[model samples]
Target: MISTKIPFVIFKSFFNGSIRIKLDWESLISEQVTINMSFFEELENPSSWYLPWYLNDVDEEVSYLAPNARQLTLADIPKAINHLNSKRRDKIQELLSRFINSTQPVQLVIATYALPDGKHLIMDGNHRSSALILAGVKARLMVFEMFGPLDPELLPDLRLWKD
Candidate 1:
């Protein structure tokens, strides 16, 4: 677990709706492997935007609540590729195989955004996360990028770019 010894009152405010989130920006930069959720979405589906930075930018001032550091195994996470087409699935599988053969550690990127329901939404890295699951690896390091105050009701309207 990645514990910074955050106070209980902070957690309380986060869930009580007083605070939007509890994000650690330091970790994201130090890791140098964060997936920009906003950018990923903009790339997947072109949308009208005022600026290029807006394409991938996340608001730093917005606070969010996320777990200290989760030491998760395969059973801990949901299947990341359920929504993907066969072609994408296969490509991911190939990558997974390569990963298995390599000496490098399997570090997965996870983007955590606050949902109105108070649960963190796991975005991106489905393929890599799923690969970790399939390999039956326990305790992989998952880097998190946090966003939100997003309405849970809007979840239905949201979809990952799979094309």
Candidate 2:
């Protein structure tokens, strides 16, 4: 489940009256992608959604969506944020602040799996996994989930990209 969060937009245009479309969330991240961080950042701006370099050339493997069972949200800091300091502290704080100030819901990605005992395990989305701690989100996640653990023998060959 590829849940990349940002501001959610709800409005109407002459093309579609009374329509609702959630602007792709630009702050929340569930899966990892190799695109340049700047490229992703540009997508957050309404004007950048159509740029050719935005989402440019994504790997097919990165397209998998995670199920909600194999994920969990810990109250502690997200692993990605624990290392923040002067360089990115303000940016992170600003992103979160803007999100809270917006009138939209937060987005997240979760990886889940079922157990023989009938319990679910969420392997990801610690920042906001539980409802009690859920940010202003209507849907808890939007994931690009991958299947069972990879078997090296069944993996595909790698190829280099060319400009």
* Per-prediction backbone clash count: 7, 36
Model 2, residue 100: what's the lDDT?
62
What do the candidate models score in CA lDDT, each in turn?
0.36, 0.26
User: TM-score for each prediction?
Assistant: 0.40, 0.28
Evaluated at residue 104, the lDDT of candidate 1 is 55
- The sequence of per-residue lDDT tens digits that candidate 2 reaches over residues 46-148 is 2111100111122111211212111112332233243324344354455556556656555554332222222322333322343213233333344322222
RMSD of each: 15.9, 16.6
Candidate 1's residue-wise lDDT over 1-163, tens digit each?
A: 3413333333333333322223333343343232222222111111111000101122121112221222222333233244345665686688678667757555554444433333344444445555655554433454343433233332221222112
Scored by lDDT, model 2 comes in at: 0.26
Q: Which stretches of candidate 1 lie over 4 Å from their true place?
A: 3-84, 115-119, 145-147, 152-163
- Evaluated with lDDT, which candidate comes out highest? 1
